[model samples]
Target: MIPGVMEAAVLNKPMDIELKQVPVPGIKEDEALIRVHCIGVCGSDVHYYEHGRIGRYVVEKPIILGHELAGEVVQVGAGVTNVSVGDRVAVEPGVACGRCEYCKSGRYNLCPDVVFMATPPVDGAWAEYVAVRSDFLFQLPDGISFEQGALLEPLSVGMHAMIRGRVNPSDRLLVTGLGPIGLLAIQAAKIYGVTEIYATDIVPFRQDLAIEMGATAVINPAKEDLKERIAELTSGRGVTVIVESSGNGRAIPDALTTVNRGGRVVLVGMPAAKEIPVDINTIIDGEIDVYGLFRYANTYPSAIQALGRSDIDVERVITHKYALKDIQEAVEVARTEKETSIKVMIYPQL
Candidate 1:
């Protein structure tokens, strides 16, 4: 039997998390109730817990903050038919309004009124049970664990980055940042048949993770000159494609110099500064194509298929795990332990 109420980790204010008893969310006619098994601690979740906001989205009230989640369906609404009770599934956090122009064009990630889970106003899947749109949930095969299911959210971003950059088999890729997204981008590039993949990071741990995740070589930009390294690696021709996931303003300019003429640059990470200086001359002269990536659209199905392959193991990115009761520590680790932590996961049912 489903309980009427459940325990939830709510962010009351900046640096404050409370475990409170809340009524289980009632589902709409087209929704399904999921018993959340695993939820990944995202960078945005930590930012909200630490500063109470990300850009314009502010925490005006206490809210549950987790978006990367996967679980089993506990119940389904009358109109729901996509998934049934007892099915393990991965929930796509963004529920875009299908009537919008962006959604009609199949670019729903740009939906102006997208209700993304854990993005300020929308309460997310950090609780024992979460109700979500039935269509947004994708069934997870037996080969894919709940942890890998949760990771599909970030992995979708990596996949979207490759899509935006128009990644091809012949491309020599340069991923500037070995964070979760950058490492996953390497895997995505490899999946797309790109053979020569190079990655960069300032931290030694992430650099090591880059190689483990499928990078041909990892460059520590702090210790070595990134431009010189890229030049030597590509035999002075520079990389054919660049995916900038570091979100560091300084790295943007450096990455621009390492790409070959007519290379594609996909900006996946949001930089702290609203505006940063870039070389317009390089972009014009080199005829470089730059693409900005928002959240992913229509990537859940492919992400599931990709992660389900025996060869693609995204679980390796997980560095820490915690039960929902210990969400405070989980957020702290993701926030302060940048050097050691990559992805922190939480099990709400534990």
Candidate 2:
């Protein structure tokens, strides 16, 4: 028996997340009603909570703000057949219009009509009950916890960046920024057979965590010369692949300098500055291939498979947990405590 109302953490505006009682969302014929179990606190979620916007997306009205989520199917619409009630699943928050050219070309993440969850106007999975399109939900194996299922979203981002960078066994990779995405990139690189992996971050905890997660070497950019360290690691040849997840203005140019000639640099981070000056000369002279990632496409299955394996312990990244009622505190800790926290998770059911 679905209740008429459910509890949710609603952002009335920036820094104003309220635990309110809202009507359970109704599902369309192709959608299912999920009882949200765990939701990961993404950097974008914190940005929106603190700043009320990210680039063009703004909180024009009240919205629920969480995208990385996992839940159990409580009910299904008449037309839903892929999953039934009681299925544990991870919800891919982006619902794309299948008719778009990007969708037809198998790059639905680029679909112009994508209604991404937690992106303004699209309510996300912060509530107790969320209506997700059946196609966007992936079943979780029994062994995978809800927390790990929620984390698959960020893992997918790392996987996508690695794919865009064309990571291979022979490639020496450099991952800038040891945020959740950067850490996951290290795991993804290892899975892809990249033996030599280097990571950099300003946070000592993150740098140490990166090393624990199989990074060959970790550098503290604030204290050390990053370019010199990369040069020393690569014997002055520079890394073959660079995954720039920091979005730090300085990291961008440094990556260009540290990447080998004809190397690939994949930009995964959303930079704080809209227009940072780039070294166009280096890009042109080195013939470097640069790729920009927007969310992810066709990566959930791979991410889930990777998590199923024992080699990569994705759960280790979770450093904090909070109930839905304390969402504001969770967001605050995630925003202020970067050095100590890797990932903060919210248990909506609690």
Candidate 3:
């Protein structure tokens, strides 16, 4: 007995957001209708709001924006079997055509025909209800809160970076950002058995939060010599893995300087600049392997399992919450209040 219409926050243009009643989405044969409980505001969402695009994904028309979300399943189509009414779940935002080669090979994140939520031309979960493929929804464990469930999306990013970096128990890692992704990356590294982890950021609060999230040490890159500190911490050998989530142009060369020879540098952040100058000799001399990460592939189940465990506290990163009506302010705080806000969440039902 879902309503025919639901409230949604629509982005008509850059910096123009409006709340209006829109028709509830209809479920497909393999889709389920969910009543959204919580949605996390991501940097991508804010980027689209403020800049109207990210790279080439431009918003050509009115769109609903938000992707990191968790909710209760309220309706299902004929082919839906994985979730039922009242099941609390986290939504994996990317939907790939099963016939695609990337999908068949388990690399659906790179699928050419994939329709990812909030990435232009696809309406996302900033509304009261969303209809998503049943397989993309994972049931939340008994003790996991909706906020934590929504956070699985960013957690998946960190997990994907960890996998790409091939982080191990013996690896000493450097995470160059204190954003939500950086904080989650530190936690992911700890979960992967890396005992020595270092994090650097321009913001002190975020640096402190990183320490709380299990970093062995935190550095302020604006005031401190990051490469020298890493040298001191690693006893002049440098770290084995550098997880660059900041997308800062300067961080790239710093990573090349601080990473151990033959080590890996995983780039998770999307840089604003289209092209960055790189010293080919530096990369060649160290034989540093660089890896690029897009949104995660095949990580939803592992993210859910990690959330079910008690050791990792995903909720700690959340610093602010707002009702759907306050989405404008929410996005502003997330964009302007970086030092004080790590993760901002929205409650559509509120």
Candidate 1, residues 1-350, lDDT tens digits: the string is: 99999989999999999888999999999999999999999989998999999999999999999999999999999999999999999999999999999999999999999999999889987899999999999999987899989999999999999899999998999999877888888888877888899998889899888888888888888898887888888788779999999999987877676788899899987899998999989999999899999988998888888885666778889999999999999999999999999999999999
Q: Residue 51: error of model 2 in Å?
A: 0.9
Per-model TM-score versus the true fold: 0.98, 0.98, 0.98
Give the alpha carbon lDDT tens digit for every residue of 161-197 in model 2: 9888888999999999999999999988987888899
Report the poorest 10 consecutive residues by lDDT, candidate 1. 304-313
Please report, in order, the local distance difference test score of every candidate based on alpha carbons: 0.90, 0.91, 0.91
Q: How many residue-pair clashes does candidate 1 contain?
A: 0
Prediction-by-prediction clash tally:
0, 0, 0
Model 3 over residues 41-148: C-alpha lDDT tens digits? 999999999999998799999999999999999999999989999999999999999788899999899999999999998998899999999999999989989988
Query: Sort by TM-score, best first: what order?
Result: 1, 3, 2
Cα error, residue 108 of model 2, in Å, equals: 0.4
**Model 2 error, position 257 (Å):** 1.1
TM-score of 2: 0.98
Report the CA-based lDDT of candidate 2 relative to the real structure: 0.91
Tell me the lDDT of model 3 at 6.
97
